[model samples]
Target: MTKKHYPLFLLMMLIFGMMQVKAQTSLNDIKAILQSPYFEKLYSNTYYSLLDRMRKDGFLPESLTGAYEGMYCRTTGAMVSLLIETSRLKEAELNIKCVLDATTQNDMERIPHVIGIKDNKYTIISDEHQIDGQAHVLLAWARLALKRGHTNFEDKTWPLVSAIMKRTCDRTFFQHGWWSVEPGLVRNISFEHSREGRRWDVWDLLTQSFVGAALNDMATVAERRSETKLAADWRKKMEILQQGIRKNLTTVRNSDTTYLEMRLPDSNGGTPYLGMGWVTLSPVAAQWEGLNHQVMRNTVKAMQQGMLKKTNGLAWMPTDSYPDGTVSNEIIGKGQAWEMEFARTEKDYNRIKAILDLIKIVNAPKPVYMEGGWLDGNGHKQSEKISDTDLAAMNNAVWKTKDAGNGEQCAWWCWAMARLRVAAGLPAEPARVK
Candidate 1:
């Protein structure tokens, strides 16, 4: 009741009110950036523009002006996810048909990593049968079916989905719950860090996480469709896979949990740690349910400490740990986008803003372009130039430094931005082409 006590009470109330205001301002600030004209234009240009380049058969090439040819299944699957999330149901359906059409015309039911057109027919370009690619496509199908409210497996995509599940379940190599990446397979080419001619026949965390997630998705679809036995089988496989990941692919030291990039097949093999890059981020990126929250936090902490870098004051995560034991300083566009999504999930507002700033800066000078441009470690663009008309016509998806865009990178970036918008409580749907 004293005047002195009243002053103290009033000051406390003032501090609490200021704290509430600061929290609201933080969220509002994020929303403002996401809703800005610049951000909206970037999303529209990356998305609808890329869709404009899709082939009649639904084949979206890896790059527009770059040296890439054919359709990468994994990339196409990413595009499918983007389309479905944006409510482009018709486009998503056509893309799914493209994937089914590309499936090998054999009993193996194998889906090639790259399917190219030859004589108006789909030909296998790289037949590595990557587990993650398979997972991506299967997950895409499950998502599309679920989104369309198909609860009885009566959708046109059901037959293909069933065949893929059967093939996956029948693979002898996958009998152990988690499959290993075979040595000399072309799948290594898609992995940024493992592309340097490394001999690998080991269990990789990326593959495990993706496959596990896909299994979960498929199981949900099966459960909804009243496929009780199939759902139970898939749930069991997922549990085993999760156990395998935890028992073999994770390590702990000084109370800090670290997920290994790949576990050696044999006991005598060396340590599985690969210096923290995409592989380390995969578990969280896939949102694997088996992962402990503390483990995800530790993995993010490791990436921030080891892989985070800056160029011209813009933040990026450089590609790390080639097979030759050397690190790269190049900013793989897709990798940065993946990290951006992760940052948004973790609510690291500062990290998200830094990445957005980097993207805005790199893409600001949009007229000139190149195919497969070299973005060196120091965040410099090194590639020959093309005209603005060419870029507008092609509307490539991926932008690596100054190189002509690729579909995979563009899809990933757009997907990340879309997620950011949703997080900011803005519209999840991107602006349609005018």
Candidate 2:
């Protein structure tokens, strides 16, 4: 921990100073954030929270006993990363195998979007298939399997991943592009944690980031297996994905800057919130790189102009921007946390410092109330109001923003475990970071 650490500083102290820290983060400073009181609390509390929920039946229910109780496919991979980073080898292997063992086959995809745990047995709970679920798992599997220098684990797991990630047996996507979820549609399709209606499918900055990371993971694993041809192919795909995103999905904001859109332009043409969000920041989780990633530097510049809010303490910027020309006010801690890691990836010390300040303000680990992020157009707090009311009974006066819809709790912020990994110099699992 840094000698400068204090457990009780007021959250507002750095509200102004954080912006001035444009300097790069030293490795020691990164270690300091990792060992800081906030990180320790975030790491241990969240890990235990998930550990307590790990059922002997080999499933980690979304909630111990609540309406939202079930398994989300994305959590497992991020959880596996947590265990691996912390040296919980057996436990990590158990979770990885648990998820693989329970994978149910669907014509649509092998990896189910949601699974329900009941009386020690888990079953598919939804028809939905999300690319993020498969991406997170593949990334985790690749990293852990590589660390052990063995292909047995991947050989065992590959059948399922291949099925889920497979675009065509002919491997047509190996050249052009790939989807995040399987039966991988290239048109409007429902995706993970999205309820605003089907957006463009096939690819998005959000899903492609993770999928590209997975491709790189597979590339590394293939290289390790001495499958040079396969590794080269995977590497090419990863590059294509990353470069494609850098090329097609960004807009020249002005002569001096450019920013990535939330997803490629949808026919719907909704929300200015599109360009500046987790959609841009979330890509920091991957090993994929471009000739230059100035897109993020510009993104941080654009976001700071408005997005990151200060109510209830300095919060990460809200999730979405609406068509009405207003950005969200409610803070989503998971998004904030992951964005902090994104800053860490870029060595943006000031952003990381601001986010750590927020964890202290909100008492993140203990109860994990993801501070509401939807803001009134006037910059007043509306996160709680918007979250409390989902689609059907929205408030006329309230800002329209949809949250993760866990009226109860989001499995004690299981995502925190992985964000901690990113803070510890491991890559973040984008989709699962939430």
Candidate 3:
């Protein structure tokens, strides 16, 4: 590779270094679970029932109010979105209220990344802030509003949105007219793949895309409420963000362009996302306004060839990796939300089906039910060993590790299935599946 072409080559090298998990699950042998009657009835029914009880009993964790220092809580945005999609409007609204009520002076600090679940009550389990988590919660609010035609709970919901954005006055909330790329983009500066508090200048693709989408959605709310100036400002800022993302995040591979992870101000290269579905979930993948089409397609190609699992082809992406095919993650079902969303957005039927085949409960040969998500393969290098399972046993070995698991109905697994239903022209509700 010559000097001019070495950057893309090196980017590909960084991707190829991701370890391909030896999935224990058989990709071809995935049962016709999506076509089954039990998908909406038996499996999901059982899972959601359990989740509701957990919420009532304080056994489950809420994403917004509960987060740990060393962990990533990705479920809130998706979780809230999933809740709204399932006709659980009241429940979804209650959860939204719990998050909104915390906009006070003392509560604003905890607002960005507070963690915990409300079990008939509210609480905080972790105080660590994750920009993506904040973006997700914001996105969730937007989605819920859109779904509700932007009404019904405006008394509380509107106040919350107004308050959060109003914090731009306070340095703690956002900057005044902080709409420019350099000074305006809210910098949550975080690390992907649980780098254990490693800080990179914010504006990473994952957070950028999510935050950008959220901003646009909020602009819609502003327009509806007749906040014309605010709406216009938001749109203009979103355009600038769009320009910023393209300028900072795009890279070339084999002359095919794609977006890179973090584009630090003085960085030589950008970070690649190996943690399952973050790439596909990028704003580009979401097909949000202002993304480069070639870049998006190239991104899908790069991930499928280099970042995704080569073993079963359906489990998950690597948690961490280098140029030597080393990896440290297993199958995470929720990550599939982006995978399925990307596939649907790209109109790739085959890719969409691959994701659905995994979520189809019956296709899961293992005895486990969906919780967070399940593995298609084992990551021996990625996780610890259990007493019953040998050093490399894959699925049931979860008692000894975190970061990988089954897809529970109330989590990303179920949410992904819902997206698939839309892609397949089926009812979004799994229960209505034929």
lDDT of 3: 0.51
Backbone clashes in each candidate structure, one number apiece?
4, 12, 16
Comparing 2 and 3 on lDDT, the stronger one: 2
The positional error of residue 286 in candidate 3, measured at the CA in angstroms, is 5.9
lDDT of 1 by residue, 1-434 (tens): 89879999999999999988765435467778777777777777677756888877787877766667778888766787788767887777777677778784533475678888887877787877576777777877777777887633336656677767756654443445223432211122233233343445556777777677777888898888788898898888777776666766777644787776775555342246555566666765565645676777777777777556544455666555433333443455666677788878778777777767766666666532111222332222333222223223333223355444677778877777777888888776776634
For all candidates in order, the CA lDDT equals 0.64, 0.54, 0.51
Most accurate candidate by TM-score: 1
Give Cα distance to truth, residue 168, candidate 2, Å. 8.1
Which regions of candidate 3 deviate over 4 angstroms? 1-32, 37-51, 54-74, 102-106, 109-112, 116-121, 150-152, 166-185, 195-201, 265-277, 284-290, 312-316, 320-325, 356-379, 383-410, 432-434
Ranking by lDDT: 1, 2, 3
Best by lDDT: 1
- In candidate 1, list every pair of residues with a backbone clash: 329-377, 370-404, 397-410, 398-406
Tens-digit lDDT track of model 2 for 68-109: 547776776656655665566666677767767767432444
Candidate 1, 405: how far from true, in Å? 2.4
